[model samples]
Target: MSVSDFLAFTKKNKNISPKIRLYLIDKDKHYFINAGTLKNGFSPKLTIANNRDSVLSAFSKMAFLFDELIRLRIVGHSNESDSSELLYLLNLVPINRKIRTFLDWKVFGPEFTRDMSRLFEVRNDTVHCISLDEVTYHPKSKVSLSSMSGFKKFRTDFQKAWKTLLEIYVTEQEKLDFKKLSMG
Candidate 1:
């Protein structure tokens, strides 16, 4: 929806509490300096906030699954090793450290893991109030779809990595955890 329409809707909806006042900027002042769009080649949508939420949600899930794969593959090693043990060890290591350890081990080639790195970049960009996402205005705000530039490649990369992890790491379909997924 256009900024004007969004403003109209916000005013109409009594339940909607806006964090910031909604106003229209001069169309000329609206600009997006999106290097992520060039890098990921993903376009932003007209419905900015929903698109952002969806992308964030998908990336969050993939990042979580990636971390789980690390725990099961690196720490758990086998079904008999104990799920509690896997989670306990996982509790000790931060996600960044885990990814670095996985890379250091070279269990999977960088080709498969590059996206993992990108996930961090994208996540950092999203989480840490970086430009693009930070510069990005609220939905229905008078700005281009700026924050969404980093998300285009995230889902695809995550899916590919998750697929490879399943193919290589999964040992059982029924249980689907350290017990079934252990490399040992």
Candidate 2:
């Protein structure tokens, strides 16, 4: 869509209000932007966008959020650096197929992964034009403003998935901390 459309969608999310700030930058003749916010009461400025990046910036921000959560040990993981892989490295699952089968969806759960996968699929449809129908109809679809509705749906789903992940991480961390303190 347009920058205004992105801003409007972000504005509707109350959680993002106090938590995030979006900035648009011109990098190498292309418009890039980054989303920044306070992390754990400390502002850790992050690059949420890149050159010519559009909707991918939003997806990247979601991934970064999960990465930060995992880094903080708010989410359970066998390793720390796997945060980025968990969010973006889809093929890593096949490389280490056992890790894929072992992912405790009972702990991390499946809802976030499923929603994120859908978001990635929609993004791929927008970017790669692998769908012949999308290649032929997208411009006209945008003219009719139907694409904006789909964009809104994608944005909503992404936000929901991010928020759900955050909640799960925070709750799990709290439980772990409580148990540790009780045992101590």
Candidate 3:
């Protein structure tokens, strides 16, 4: 819809208070160019350019872009549907196999892959668990990340994952574009 149409809707929909409407409009504009798609904030261009977008939001975007990487033939084989394919490969493929495959490809370095693996572990913990049990003691569990400082570290890890994934996505996109042009 046009800007005038949106403004008229905002006027009629009093439930969408001025602040809420403005925030939604700004959010849609910030991530997606148009609100006509009604994606509910589901765009694959989920890179953390600035602090405006939360780390979790970017992580969600990165997850969606995994399919893009698969489509581009960058991460996994398109034909391997059973388990080798990128589709839900994170849950199906063993960690060792994942490391082996990633090591073979130079798009990401060994150390970075290691870090990304750890990040995913944390992400899984955060996603799978229903709620975090309260920790009373000072020294928190090192592995589970049940404390505030641990949660902070999780955020840092997600930020790194988002940035690293964005770099890989851009590099692969350029390579694909060059290949298509050369082929043409």
Candidate 4:
């Protein structure tokens, strides 16, 4: 449904609690706003000086979606993160055979790992200025604009990473379903 339609439905729907309704509205708003912004930016009239903003926007959405997939796979529910909490949790997951296989076969080889590494670096250093590295450098005094080429790489990497995570989630879910059926 469209954002307006969703809003209208939410206004009439009384079964959902205020908190849930608000969350749903916010989720729709994120999609609506992102789609609109991307559409506007893609037009010939709009001169996008740098791709940093667009790349960051795509990376943010991809990261959130990746985190949500992880939450759903592990906890049977989804949660959003505003900081590095999800990244920390992801790091904590043991890189066992199953995960390794998933990353290799289900995803596109080591590209998932590479993309995620780039995404994390860009997210921390380029976007937030919060270094997740062991050797952190002092913040630059001047604002640095990201190169168009770098943004192109970021956009492509984010897409691969997001797609890999989604495929992993789907495969894991199928495995869960098989186990349930076998047990039943």
On residues 1-184, what C-alpha lDDT tens digit does candidate 4 reach at each position?
4334544443354222211101111221322112112111111112222344654565455554444445444543222242235447665653343235445554435755544654555555546543222212222222233444444444454555555555554444443332221221
lDDT of 3: 0.44
Residues 1-184, candidate 3: write the lDDT tens digits: 4333444454454233211111112222322112222224344244433222243455555555554554455432123343234456565655445545655776668877776666655445445444443211112235334556655555566666666765675555444332222221
Q: At residue 34, what lDDT does model 4 achieve?
A: 24
**Local accuracy of candidate 2 as per-residue lDDT tens digits, 96-163:** 23213224435454554544555555445546653323521221233211355544544455566655
Report the Cα lDDT for residue 46, model 2: 26
TM-scores for candidates 1 onward, in order: 0.44, 0.41, 0.49, 0.41
Q: lDDT, candidate 1, residue 98?
A: 64
Give the local distance difference test score of model 1.
Answer: 0.42
| Model 1, backbone clash pairs (residues 3+ apart or across chains), number | 1
Instruction: State the RMSD for candidate 4.
Output: 11.2
Query: Candidate 1, residues 1-184: lDDT per residue as tens digits?
Result: 4433433443354333221211122122221112111111112211123354654665554455455556545433233335457657777776677667767777556655564665555555566553444523222223323523323334444456555654443332112332221111
Q: Which predicted model would earn the best lDDT? A: 3
Best by TM-score: 3
For residue 101, model 2's alpha carbon misses the true position, in angstroms, by: 7.4
Ranking the candidates on TM-score from highest down gives 3, 1, 2, 4
Off by over 4 Å in 3: 1-60, 74-100, 134-144, 178-184
Instruction: Identify the runs in model 2 with alpha carbons over 4 angstroms from their true place.
Output: 1-54, 72-105, 123-146, 175-184
Candidate 4 Cα misplacement greater than 4 A, ranges: 1-53, 77-111, 129-145, 175-184
User: Which candidate would rank higher by lDDT, 1 or 3?
Assistant: 3
